[model samples]
Target chain A: MSRFPAARLAGVAALALLGFLLPRLLGGSAHVYDTLTTIAIFSAMSYGLDIILSDLGEISLAHTAFFATGAYAAAILVVNYGESAWVGLAGAVIAALALALVLGLITLRTREFAFSLVTYAAAVVCMNIAANWDFLGGSDGIVGIPPLALTLGRFSFVAGRPAQFWPVAYLLLLFVLYVVARFRRSRLGQAALMVHMNPRLAAMCGLDANQVRLHVFLVSAPISALAGWLYAFQRAYVGTDLFDTYFLVLMLTGVILAGRRLLLGPLFGTALLLGQKNFASLGAYGDALVLGTVLVGVLCLCPRGLASLWRRRAIPGPEAPSLPGGPVSG
Target chain B: MNVAQQFANGIIIGHAYALVAVGWTLLLGAARLVNFGHGQMYMMGAFVAWWLMSATGLPYAAAVPLAVLVGALLGALMQRLFLRLTLSQDLVNLMIATLGFGQILQGAAGLAFGAKPERLTSPLQAITLGGARVSCSAQDVLLVGATIVVFLGLHWVLRRSRFGAAVRMVAEDPPLAALYGLRVAPVYLAIFAFEGAAVAFAATLVAPRTPILTSIGFEQVVMTFVVVVLGGIGSVGGSYVAGLLLGLYTAFFSALVSPAYTTASVFALLIVVMVVRPGKLAASGGFAR
Candidate 1:
């Protein structure tokens, strides 16, 4: 009740600060670094999906197409043309963005069921092309992708193993988060909320509802593609399944369950989802079970997502939309 | 086989697609959302019938209907359990939830039934017709026959019965129907269960003809979905026609092209239809005028 209404948030932030520092202080060992790298990659990818889900209320189970496209683009550039990792990364984002634009323009003009059918089909087609095309290594994917190089950056991750991936992944995660945060606050972001709220009203206000959605979708796709690119690069190989259905499902669960009702929900969802890769017996299924449970639970219980927990505690500046006004299409 | 025989084989495949297509059309039209888990239900029905008649002492007639009932109950459970929580979310989420539900069912089947193909006994021997000699096994004939009967029955129900009126009323306008004393929720649940029964029935009919395996559900659902969309989303009759058309297309196409593109070709057809007239597939607002 005191004037400093949410002192608990400060404590939470302090704890986060300490936890993050502890990893660096402990000298980011290989095993620990791999886990951290996955967390960063997963979080960044989840945020990309939020453009469709939490921001626009659209569901994109096909985001993995973007990821796979980016990774392949990067690898193809490096292996075929001898480009650096940064060039590959930039190229991946551009490729993802272009595909997203075309996909978004066509699919978002329609309503619920149609939206799903088109997007899912698009992703499946992409996976098929990748799988069947011999140049992409058919089912084998691109192996032996050279380590992403750096010329001008102060923080360069000279990769010998996946553990070496953290520094580069961490930087990419930071850049993605920073850019997305800014994008969320701009007029374009507000236009997104407007279009989602009531397209008729948004149109009345002189906004092109469909165009705005297309823009957001295009943007989100590249982000996903960037994540895919990094994942493929980090792992040093891309396989057919990299852009296939299961990848899409995992990405959807993370982003949708994240509930961008607050900023932290997607991050939390990503951490929980990718973490299930640990248990030996559960294996591939463990992530799926957790996804099913969390999706059902969040849809039923905490529609706003875990991030709302942070948003609820007396923070007064931003007036984030309540979960009921969630951006998803009904 | 002669060239004519190959063409005849395509129609046989069309018959298979018809069963799934009709079910998908009716369900999506009435339910407002689709169940990706439906293929799983079809697989279950087949497996259940396979187990009952082929393994246990129960006869085929009893097993088929019995399997249908089980599928309906599971459908009701899906509605009562998952859809119950999801009505408030975006339809996109609902679709994904159903897909997740399908995955859960697939995994559960893998755990419970094992990932092997099983066969069921056909109740009736194949019947010959005209100059063409196609063996209509009891199960296949029964299934295709049941599909025809169900369509006629659905047509009658939609055009005639009070239950049909309630469904049309609600789908056309939910609140207005509620004002007219139609109970919307129960009718919706009934439709969900009804669709499940259809899928199960299709499975019971199909099990004798095709190899029953865990992977069969995905193909069945995709085929059904394609037919439903092609026929136009909410038109029950459109589904039947579309189903037959697709069945014929795949039947002939496979005879010409490889079997691999059969599914991909269906998807391509859907994309073409969608791009041409987006509203046709929407299935609401009464056939886009």
Candidate 2:
């Protein structure tokens, strides 16, 4: 069962190489390129929340704020300051980091619903400011973002078409997936699990729960923001709609759809969701209904998520897998 | 900008906030449950009332009670769906479930009522207060009176009634209350139904003041949060006072500074409060008192 590290690395590389060809292998149409590129971008966005929701065992509803911050930062830099994609990416990370610091400190002591409430409020505040502040283009939002151009000394890559953009988006997704995998193996990840599953045990083990939470939050925001950075170039626009609940719900649904603790869960979930939106073509209202129903149904009927459903069937156990924090015994 | 008129307007706004928040106050304080779909439910209430009045040619007053009834039914439906989660006190899942329910409601409203904004008109909106220099609508007067009456009634019920005592007992410790022969599920269902009915009632009174939209679901409930949090979480009387103070704060802030930033400012205040004193949201003994 224990494979050599070199073999595992080769396997991962092969899979990534295959992913680069996935769009062409599927349909080879521009629509396929556009759809796959979106899936990759949104999946990257979902991974940010996946780390927090699945590993840290906390829901930061303000992930949308981070996502929006990146888009806006990238949009503003490219449109207003004529900055390169690299600078825009830097701006996104810095803005999200600053926001996470403030939010993390504010919500350090709060647990459960209080944490969610504060984060949700923070996201709404960001939206409100974005909607009103003319410097951010008010409701009109920042537009005319130039195509992403990352250049280095006589070598340059410009992503002006969906096919041209696919590699960048795919690379970003792979990078995020690598970061998430590395994070799951890191000491901070272990500490976050301890803090979530057993607070007293975590404290006794010499971990500061709040510090772990803050660190994890600080790390998580830039991941989503990076996705947004790419997304701004793809869309050529950034608006307050980036902070909408639809994105939040979509992110949450993606994280939980395939199951927690699985690295590919959110990626697969996002692909399925966006695929449905792209191919099936439900009107907006119907799409919302489907997304909401899926989220609620998963949490209610199969709390371990869809991945667990097949696992349960394969194992054929009488005693079902218990949900974390089961029933809170009195 | 007339100072007295703004002040009067602030009072009406304050009462409206309190009324809208009353159901959430009970749900949080008594049931120890959170509903993220709260704003959607309020949206549903207003739309249902609007639909009834428009389709049936019913009087605005008559449509309100019917809308409250529908709200109660919706609440019951939610309770039915979430009974398991409620029994377990799974706050996180419950919150998300409510959000899903709200999404469903929003989609349904969009399909049924369309996306366009519609005004919920009341006959009382036409009746004006005196002097024309500093005045309000009769609907505003009705809202203020209704808020006072509801608060007083809730206080009386929570403190002096047997059912309220049962609810408080459940809130303090559900398993223990169940062991002592309390029918826990029914209590939860009743509380949810009350939440729906009360918020729906608030919608009829308050929604007439503005144009209603299904999209407002996401943003409409922030003021309710400010009221609930500042009012000491589950304290009914506290929420009333908090609502008035917040209404005044928003009114003055909008009048003096800019209305666009008022929500951001209030949320900033919420962040400060969470940091400074989170003890206000403790899970016990803060109900009607």
lDDT of 1: 0.70
Q: Report the number of clashing residue pairs per model.
A: 8, 0
Candidate 1 lDDT, tens digit per residue, A84-175?
87788789988888888778766766756677666666666676677767777777777888776666667654675756676677767767
The best candidate by DockQ is: 2
Candidates in order have lDDT scores of 0.70, 0.88
**Model 2: CA > 4 A from native:** A317-330
Q: Evaluate residue B211 in candidate 1 and report its C-alpha lDDT on the 0 to 100 scale.
A: 80
TM-score of model number 1? 0.85
What RMSD does model 1 have?
4.7
- Docking tier of model 1: it is acceptable
**Model 1 misplaced stretches (Cα beyond 4 Å):** A1-31, A75-84, A140-156, A279-281, A307-330, B1-3, B43-63, B82-92, B115-142, B207-220, B287-289
Error of 1 at B160 (Å): 2.2
